[model samples]
Target: QNTTSFGLTPCPKWNPNGTTIAGNSSGLKGNDTSSLDRPIGIFVDVSDNNALYVADHENSRLMKFNRSQHQDQGEAIVPSGIISAESVFLDREKSIYVAGGGKVMKVIVSGVGETILDGETEGEIGFHELSMTLYGIVVDSNDSLYISDGSYHRVVKWEKNSTNGTLIAGVTGEYGDDSTHLDFPHGIYVDFDYDALYVADINNNRIQRFHPIGNLTGETVAGGNGHGNGLGQF
Candidate 1:
């Protein structure tokens, strides 16, 4: 149940003159050559903000936008090969990482798509052998991806071209209100300059940080005394 409506509307300053762009009042979902449905992930091209890439999840495609030319709509870069795309990350080489459907896919700027990790295998580029709720991916400067798993309550780090990931944070199969555990971790960020990872522990009502490296040992940097509006709360 999506209580509220969803649509891709232009930001205020982007088009100050208020010209029409992609999408309509009706949240219609469709593939390339049509409107988007349940679009989730979006990334602005580093060199060109007008050129935005979107993970058209339900459409199983990636859409690219040229604000100057395609303000009315975006064009599909990869016409197929994506599933339930939840998040998208741009690498240094301009490739995109799509996270969803129990797999992490790499979409080259040239529109080639390949699977980097899935839940089944064990040898390399495989998630742990268990049901995984993958979300919140952050790519480090070295092209390493740090992903969070809400189902297993842990974070895994997969190096570029690696066969498997190293569990870096959280306790597997455990959820608690302590520094050693995380409850429904969401939204991860990596600070390459400082060598730290930050996680939003949603259910725990706090944010945690793993410094130097993700060693599963986290320190509460904010919100510990439960959700609230006062200082040092929520």
Candidate 2:
């Protein structure tokens, strides 16, 4: 669902033990259409009857699990050509965005896939020139894409039908724990109402918030102290 609210709503206290709504309860991995192998990214399409879309990474495809039906098996939606699918996002129009294999693809529910951004290919207008190892992807209300380029250690914003992407956070090819730097950024989320971008800075073990309006340097929102099992640690 599209939201215009800023900041996160505190989740109500619930049971610590959670139920497995999809996939095998034993955590077994499989390559079949009914099972998932190294599924990395997931998006719940609340608008579409709460259908859960998964980036079936190792299987190189996308899977859709219907919540209403409470099915254990997921239907393979985009059945092929999404090698090492790392992340998946669904826009307001129900268009699917997939990130994998140094490329980002746009796919419809009917299974038509189009490569919109190819990091391996060069010299194409509106295509990124850098070799991107994409991890996370989120599309804004305007259909602009915010992607975490793991190889580049940065986050970039690709305007809808634009020439190239603009750097949103971190420096290209640089990694650091400083405010202006990031290391192997993974998941990314855009708050439309806040006009901010949240990044899971993987290597740095922190979460960063970047405001595209004026500030290029980001602020640490969580887990910047150090890696540990204790509180306030990553």
* lDDT, candidate 2, 69-102, per-residue tens: 9788888777755556889888777788988777
Model 1 over residues 1-234: C-alpha lDDT tens digits?
A: 001123766853354555434544365656645477777667666466546777777777767778756565677666666555666777777777877666777878687888777764444333553233556777767778778777677777888887767877788767887877888776777777677878888888888998877667899998887888878888
- List the candidates' TM-scores in order: 0.74, 0.89
lDDT of 1: 0.70
By summed lDDT, the worst window of 10 consecutive residues in model 1 runs over 123-132
Each prediction's whole-model lDDT (CA): 0.70, 0.79
**Model 2 worst lDDT window (10 residues):** 123-132
- Model 1, residue 199: distance off in Å is 1.1
RMSD, one per candidate, in order? 7.4, 3.1
Q: Give candidate 2 misplaced runs (Cα > 4 Å).
A: 1-11, 121-127, 130-132
Error of 1 at 177 (Å): 2.7
